[model samples]
Target chain A: AQRVTQPEKLLSVFKGAPVELKCNYSYSGSPELFWYVQYSRQRLQLLLRHISRESIKGFTADLNKGETSFHLKKPFAQEEDSAMYYCALSGINTGFQKLVFGTGTRLLVSP
Target chain B: EAGVAQSPRYKIIEKRQSVAFWCNPISGHATLYWYQQILGQGPKLLIQFQNNGVVDDSQLPKDRFSAERLKGVDSTLKIQPAKLEDSAVYLCASSRTDGLENEQYFGPGTRLTVT
Candidate 1:
């Protein structure tokens, strides 16, 4: 079975400080990974995907297959950046992209 | 374009009761999905629909949970004889079928509380 693991249940950081939310995965084949974010009272949205190699909202995640990790990082944290973060992988079940998500990490940036 | 829409943002029911949540996907989206999110956990895929057909329901507790996407546009998820463990948020999301990067759009979600 495939699984995603976000080791941090909560990460608290001061505003302007660097932030890193760790994510690891267990899968047998090459993986397609993504980071999703949910802000206060907002719907869950895609922050970035490893395949696109694009940065969104100053956040970036690099897929390290050797390490089996795709950690999300930002140079500086902002108050507005406090939200729930989820790491997901597209499962290879029947060719349809079924997302397998981690337990999630809540990031809180304080002033 | 309008995002996915879900109704009854919150619901409460007793154990052994029944409840349902509704969802309408974005226009022309060919794929729809349902997920369950516990209070402190990430959303888990409960079901997936492709144009009114079930692509996957492997995670759904079929004995107590059921869902239908009729007309391939609107969907409803039902939980009968609800359990306390079923308290969670039910989220609806949809994605287009054309591109390889099928980025999903999500709804506000229906929060269920079974006491």
Candidate 2:
């Protein structure tokens, strides 16, 4: 079974401070990992994916297979970055794409 | 393109009552999904449809929760005899299967409050 774990329920940080939202996963075979964000009054949207290896809005995450982790990081967090962040995993065995998401972390960036 | 669309942004009903939510995936997208998100938990896939055909529905509570996609375009999820525990956000999402990267686009979820 594929499972994504985000231990922190809430993460608070000051504007311009570095931010790291930890995410861990459990999957038998190679799985795709992703980070999705939901802003206030906005629908959920893809923030980044491990397969892409590209940063979005100054945020980046690396899929560490050995550690079974894909921690999202940024040197500095902006006030607008405050939102709910969810880590999701997609198992390759499932013929089609089906996501398993983790308990989200509410990020609060204070000015 | 217009993102996935869902109706009745909010719904409130008493336990045992029935409710239904609608979803219209992005044009040209072949896959549609329905998810249930509890207050403190992430969205859990309830069912998936591939062009009007049921693809995955392992987690869906078949006894009371039912969903369907008609003509391979729009979908609807109906929950009969709702329970208090069912009060949560019902999210609808869609993705294209043209490539290996199946990035899903989500709709502004419908918030259901079961009193």
Candidate 3:
């Protein structure tokens, strides 16, 4: 069975501090991982993907195959970065390119 | 282009009552999806359509739920004899059918409350 897990329900950090949101997945084949963020009153949007290997809004995530983890990280947290984040896994077997998402983690950046 | 659109931002109805939600995907999108999101959890795919053809409905509860994307443009999801667990946000998303690198755009979602 394919599953995604976000261990933390909420993560709080001070401005300028480093932040990391953990995400893990269980899948047999090669899977594409993604991070999505939802801001207040805004629709859910893509933050970053492991395949792109690029940072978005100063946030980056690296997929570790050995550990089956794709953790999102930011060198320094910003107040504007606070939002609900979800990790998702996608594969080809499922028709129409379906995505299985984690429970989600709420990040709070305090000034 | 414009984002996905959904109607009835919020709805409150008693259990066992029937309800329907409408969604209009971005113009020219070839894939449309419907998801149910419970509070504090991620959205779960209920059904998926590829150009008005059913692609996946494994997770959809057919006993009380049904959906259709007529003409491959707009879609509607209906639930008859709703249950208490049905109280959640229904989100609609769309994406192009260009294989990998296709990013899905989501709508604001309609919040349903079951009494």
Top TM-score: which candidate number? 3
Number of clashing residue pairs, candidate 1: 0
Off by over 4 Å in 2: B98-100
Q: In candidate 1, which residue ranges exceed 4 Å CA deviation?
A: A92-94, B98-100
Q: Distance from true position, residue B24, model 1, in Å?
A: 0.4
Give the higher-TM-score candidate: 1 or 3.
3
For candidate 1, write residues A1-111 as lDDT tens digits.
789999999999999999999999999877789999999999999999999999898998999988999999999999999999999998554366888999999999999
Give per-residue CA lDDT, model 2, range A1-111, as digits (tens): 888999999999999999999999999988889999999989999999988899999999999999999999999999999999999998776656789999999999999
**By TM-score, highest first, what's the ranking?**
3, 2, 1
Worst 10 residues of 1 chain A by lDDT: A90-99
Candidate 1 is graded, for docking, as medium
Better of 1 and 2 by lDDT: 2
**Share of real interface contacts recovered by each model?**
0.66, 0.73, 0.61
TM-score of each: 0.97, 0.97, 0.98
Residue B41 lDDT, candidate 1, scale 0-100: 87
> How many clashing residue pairs are found in candidate 2?
0
Clashing pairs in 1: none
